[model samples]
Target: MRRSRAALMAVVLATTASGTAAVTADAAPASATRATACPTGWGSLAEARAAATTVPVRDVGTGRHACFDRLVVHVPGASAASLGHRVRYVDRLRQDGSGRTIAVGGGAVLEIRVAAPGYRPETGAPTYPGRAGRPLPGVDLTGYSAFRNTRYAGSFEGETQFGLGVRARLPFRVLVLDGRVVVDVAHSWGAAR
Candidate 1:
C-alpha cells in the first residue's frame, strides 16, 4: 500500500531520465495553474569528478504539465560520473565547442551546459550521435504550449551545451536526479496570465 523511498527515487529517476519532467509529489498543486516558483541562478558544477564526460546518449522530450512545461536531458549514467552541469537563461547562445552563434527561436534561451566530453577518449568519435547533426534532432514538441525549440549547440573540451527556446524567460527549475538531468520552464510567470 506504500512505496519505499528507494522505489520512489527510482521512479523519479526513470521518469526524468526518460525526458519526462513530471511534476513531483512535493510540487505545488496542479490546480493552482500558475507557473510553479522556480528560482533562477540554480546552476552548479559537479563536485566529485575532476572533469566532465560526454558519454551520455542524450534524448530530448517535453511535457505540458499542469503548472509548467518540461525539457529533459536523459543522460544515462551517474550524475557525478556523467558531467558537471550548469543551467542558466541566457541572452544569446554560442556553441561551447565552436564559439559560433546559433539561431534559436524563442524570446529567451535556457542554456544547459554539462562539463562532459562529447567524444570517446581514444577513438575521438562523438559520445552522442551529434557529430553529424549538431542538434541531435529527434524530439518532437509539436503542440507544446511553452517550449519553442531545442538546439544541440555543440560539445567540446569536456563540456556539452544545449539551448532551450521558450516562449519567454519564465521561472525554471533544474534537477540532477540519479541518471537524469531535468529542466522545467514555467508556462506563465504567474496565475494572472
Candidate 2:
C-alpha cells in the first residue's frame, strides 16, 4: 500500500508540472508584451510654463519619427530652464500683437507661444525670418505623418507665436531642452507599436 501511494503522488506531481509548463509555453512573456505596448502617458492637453528670457528664437524646424512628428524651436544661448512656453490647441491661430487670424492647413491647429522674441531685443534684427500671416520659413511639411502645415503668427512684446497644423488632435508632449523647445505629436491614439 505504501508503494502504491508513493507512485500515485509522483504521477500527480508530474502531471501538474507538465500542465504548468504547457500554460507557460502558450502565453507570451511579460517583457515581450510590454515591448509592443505604446506609450500613452502624454495627453492632448495644453502645456504651459512662464519663464521670461532675453534669448531670441533662432529658427523653427521639423522632423519625422516612427511614432511621432517633432517640432523644434531653436533658441540660441538660452538654457532649458530659462525659456517659457504656452502650447495649446486653438480654433484659429492669431497674431501676437494684431490678433489677426492666421490660416493653417490641417484637421487641427496648435498654437505655440514662446516667451522670447523672434528678433534681437537691442537691434530689432530678425532672428527668425518668419513673418505674420505667412508660412513659416524653412519648414516644409512634405511627407510627414502628423504635421501638415506651419504658419507664423508674429512675435511681439517679448513673445513669439506660431501655428502648427496636424492631421488630427492626437496625443502630444512638450520638452524644454538646452537651446530647444521641442513638441512631439503622436501619429495615432492607438498603439504605436
Candidate 3:
C-alpha cells in the first residue's frame, strides 16, 4: 500500500492508493499518526474514548483499500465524543426510528450506531438525509470484493444507525477522526495459523 498525506480543514488524510487506504487528518500530527491494527484474524469488538461534540452528520462516503473497505460518515461539527460508535454483527438490521427489518445482500450484517445527531437541531432537519430502507445508495460498490452495500437504518434520539453488508462476517474496526467517523471491514477472515 502506497501512503500519502494531505491536510483537510484541521485534519490530515493519509491515503494509500492501488492497495489503497483511507486517511483523515486533524490538528495533532501525532494523533493522526495513530494506527489501528485491522489485519486479518483480529477481533471485531472495539471501544475507545469518545470524542466530545454534538455535530450532526452531513455526508457519507466510502473507499476501497488494500486491506479493507471503508465507510466514512462526515459530521461537520463533530468532536470525538460525537463520533463514538457501537458496531456489532447482528442477525438483521432494524430502522432506527421505525424498527423495521432491513434486508442487505451479504452473509453478515455489521450494525453501526454512532453517538451523534444526523439532523439540524432547531428544525430537526435530516443532516444525512436518506431513504427509509436504504439511505445514501450512491455509495456504490461496483467492483469491491468484500463490501456488498452500505445501508442507512435511521437516526433517532441523538444517535444515527447504519449497516454494512459484507461478503461474509469478518473482522472490522471503527475510528473517530476529527469530524468523521470511519468503519473499516477486512477483506478476508484469514486462515488458521
lDDT of 2 by residue, 99-159 (tens): 7888999999999999998999999998998888889898878878889999988889999
Candidate 3 residues lying further than 4 Å off, grouped into runs, are 1-13, 16-41, 46-52, 191-193
Which one wins by TM-score: 1 or 2? 2
RMSD values for the candidates in order, in angstroms, are 6.0, 15.5, 7.8
Error of 1 at 76 (Å): 1.4
User: How much lDDT does each candidate structure score?
Assistant: 0.63, 0.80, 0.69
Return whichever of 1 and 3 wins on lDDT: 3
Q: Candidate 1's C-alpha lDDT?
A: 0.63
* Of candidates 3 and 2, the better by lDDT: 2
The TM-score between candidate 3 and the true structure equals: 0.75
Better of 1 and 2 by lDDT: 2
Per-residue accuracy of model 1 over 39-144 as CA lDDT, tens digit each:
3442222222234554654555566554567776656674645555778777777876456788778888778776655566567676666532245467677766
Tens-digit lDDT track of model 3 for 1-193: 2123333321223442211244322322333355433465556664444443467887788876545788887776666555677888888998876779988778888888777777876789887877667746568787676788778888888788888888898888777766777777887766321
